[model samples]
Target: MNLSGVFYLGWRYLVRNRIKTLLLVAAFSLVWLLPSGLALVVSKIESQLRVRAAGTPLLLGQAGSPLELVFNGLYFTKPGIATFSFGETEAIDESGLATVIPLYARFSVGGGGGGKYRIIGTTLDYFDFRGLELREGRGLIDLGECVVGSKFADANGIGPGDAIISSPETLFDLAGVYPLKMHVVGVLSPSGSPDDQAIFVDLKTTWIIEGLGHGHEDAEKLGNDARLPVSAEDRAAAGETGGEIRLNASVVQFNEVTDENADDFHFHGELSDYPVMAAIVVPTDAKGQAILKGRYGRPGGLQLVAPSEEMDELFATVFSVQDLVLGLLGATGVGTLAIGALVFLLSNRLRRAEFRHLLHLGAAPGAVRALILFEACFVVLSSLVLSVVGLLAIDRFAPVLVRSFFG
Candidate 1:
């Protein structure tokens, strides 16, 4: 085959009808980018969910539905009952069964416009158990401090000392809402999981912000036993008269009180009356977990959950169908590309005369055949290049796409 003749015919074919070439590039690029981009997003979401679920053992919440608690607590995607008492958690640990870690999630991060960011309420052990590292200062230590995930920090322009606000009770609803501001005590290193888009704070703070940790609006009146609507001074006086003065529900948490009154004060509520969302248990041993599960089944305030089992079932049902549809769309794309190939094959028929003329001008049949092959090669290669370039641009501007569709 003559290389010079091939180049000449390829150049002629490309230059003769620029519009036709551009249309071919545009059509193939669309087909390439659509499937590729969807595949990219699906892969990302699946990978992120798996990463987030790796270390967790079980999630215990209300008995209404297992899937709701799993989604709400783990993925932060479902809304359901939000109270599992501290007493219930204690029973699991005391029953010589599972080592429980409580999860009481009831908030969201500030709006950076990508759905509601996950705001998880947990203990210090959560960071350790989940294998998360501190990015800047330190993890949540005091009640009011919070930690932001890397994506949360980067997207919202947050850092140490920056303020993170608790979004409303409703994820998408914003009516009669009072903002609760939490200070950024630390930033967490990115784990490429949902944590990167989550806000972590002490469980106490989560309850406190939502008026759940302790109920009454006024802390001054919290210590009072009079549920009959008495003020602080009256309650304090009543405490003196009421003898033995059991702690009121409103006043579960107190600080800086004297050591003498410490037992009677500061976090002094019957564990049963206190509200909780859910408990995450890490079983001390397999035998212990089995015994613990039997005990937990009877508790009124809590229910034990197997996070992994429920998650797998839910995702399998939902994503399996999604995978099927995506597979069909991908197949359709292949068929369309097949048709594009057929179109190119037929288009070559029009150039047969030209190739014959080249062959007549002392050109070998192999040279003319190579020129035809090069022209076809140009169509496929140019379309693929354009497609790659467009998808890369989409990846680079992903934040914009997220905001437009989800925010």
Candidate 2:
């Protein structure tokens, strides 16, 4: 019996029953693709999480979940995590054991239907620590100035000289936490990390958004209508018992800082007492890292953690869950293959009359067996090819999908 002739006859039979052939191919392809596709996505997520976590040596934040601190500091996520006083960072810096870079990422710009972008309040040290470079304009030099990430700038079509406004924490902010308009001074180069989606600004700029600091018009320039009544005793303490003190709605609080009024901005409280969501601690040497770790080991108010270790623990749990899911998928795939085999067996049984007629018309028994084998191989091989093509498409798009999701 000619092997090519057997294959050609089998192909013709399959083409005659094209719907069954297509269904079997699709089912078998899914059986192979599901588990493999999931594994690829998990691998991509693990790599993306590990890259930034490994780069950061340590994270300091309010005593809570170590994972939350890691996400907040490294990825600018977990915006609702508790914050520690900026004084804690100052104290850590004074120890001379590590370089402290404070991060205040509680605020965001745009929301509702506009899409929210994280406003990362950090020092110049953060840029250096992350090895970020500017692609346009210059670094932040004044209040309300910002440097946007590459992804954010590109998505919004914003560059130097454009502006971004902070989104209010709530619609009914009774404490007067209004949105602040910030000038975009620069855009960072793409780093393929979470920083690519953040908006970097001075720490004080975040404070201004929180109502901890503000700029206002000079009180003396306000007219009498804007001024509120002042007590005589209060006026006497000011060494001015003569004119009414302007201390009310008459004085306009600036929502945006310009070069002329930048100097007028001031904080309501001590700079050290301001809130920071987390801080990145970079030690000078191994010994310094040990010392800093030991110092914060007995923490009550604050906690020091290794981001890499936290990530390991997180992925450990994720992998355990992934293994369980993959096992389930494997079992399902086996069941699918069994059903496919049953379908082939039944199809052969239904074609028994045809096979018997071929045998009567001078065909050998071995030829009939070969025809069945060819049909089975065709289905299996076609499914395998389709599975491989699907995996390749997923591999190509996984990174972009993961980045967009995380960002």
Candidate 3:
């Protein structure tokens, strides 16, 4: 029996039955792609999340879901269930064991193409802590001024000297909720994390948006003896007593913070009482983390957790999902094999006349069997190659796909 002759005959038969060959290739490729592709994608997502979590030592937030806190702190995706007092930051700073960085991520800015990026209210220390460099202009030097990330700037075609107006959190009460325009002073270098998708501004900027801070003319300066031209309703609305001072239509909200009115931006209450979404705590040493955890681990209003540990907890759930997906894929693969076998047996039956003619021509039975086996081998080899190529393509696009799905 000439092995090359048998292989050639097998290849020629498959080519003649092109539709069946294509179907078999697709089925078998799916059998390989499902399980392998799933594992590859999960691993990529887990690796990316873990890498981001690794840089963040600990997340401190109001007592709530640990997953939500970690995701919000690391990814800037989750809206905090509750907010912790800025006093917590003061206390942590005074502790001397850890440095706490406050995060306020409550607003979003929608650019062209309906792409909305989170507006992160933090401080200059956040840049220093993350080792972020200004790619274009200066850092955020004043309130209501922002430093955009490289990806965000590129996506929006925005650069230094441009402005970003925050989207209104709600549209029903237009008067109460005003859109703030922030000055774009700089763009950050690519950091390969959620930070690259954010617009960073001073925490005071968020406070102003929240109605916790404002700028206005002193009502005391406008005495009762002075004749006021404004109506009583307008005066009362803009008055500093039972309502917000800057309320009426004439009370123009400072859309952009600049040198002219930056001094006028003042908080209504003590800075310590202001809210922060979460705190990123970096302990001085191993002992410091242990100590900080022990201090805050008690039943309390706030919780402190290591992001890496929270991620491990998350992966446990992910593994359970992976197992379920693999089980389904395994069942599907078994069905594919059964269908493949049926197709093979049916093809042989259909070609019985051809086989009978070959046999009458003095072709050996063993040679016929070798031809069948070679065809099966070819199908398996082709499927393997196609699956490998498909998996590689998926891996190459995994980052963008994951960001689109999760972010």
Instruction: Give the candidate number with the greatest lDDT.
Output: 2
Q: How many clashes in candidate 1?
A: 3
lDDT of 1 by residue, 1-407 (tens): 66986798688778987887787777777778777777666554554455555567777787777777766666666534667677777777686667767776666765522236766777787788778998897876666678988878888889997776675665553332344567787999977556677888877676555554322234444444534454567767766543333444434333212233323322335545666677778888888778767866784645677776765776788678778877887888788789878877787787788777877888888787777678777877887898898778767666444433322
Q: Score every model by TM-score.
A: 0.70, 0.94, 0.89
Which regions of candidate 2 deviate over 4 angstroms? 112-115, 233-246
Q: What C-alpha lDDT do the candidate models reach, one value each?
A: 0.68, 0.89, 0.84
The lDDT of model 3 is 0.84
Candidate 3 residues 1-407, lDDT tens each?
A: 87888888898999998898988998999999989999999998998888878989998999888899998898887854589899998898898998989999988888421237988888788999989999999987788889998888998899999998887766665546566789999999987778888999899898887767877555544444433455567767776354333333455556667788888777876899999999899998999899988888988688998899999999999999999989999998999999899989998898899898878988899989998999898898899999999999989999888876454
lDDT per residue, candidate 2, 343-394, as tens digits? Answer: 9999999999999999898888999999999888888889999999999998
* Residue-level lDDT for 312 in candidate 2: 91
> In model 1, what lDDT does residue 314 have?
69
For model 1, the superposed segments whose C-alpha errors exceed 4 Å read: 26-41, 79-82, 111-118, 138-141, 154-165, 168-178, 213-271, 293-303, 383-407
Superior by lDDT: candidate 2 or candidate 3? 2
Candidate 1 Cα RMSD after full superposition onto the native fold (Å): 6.8
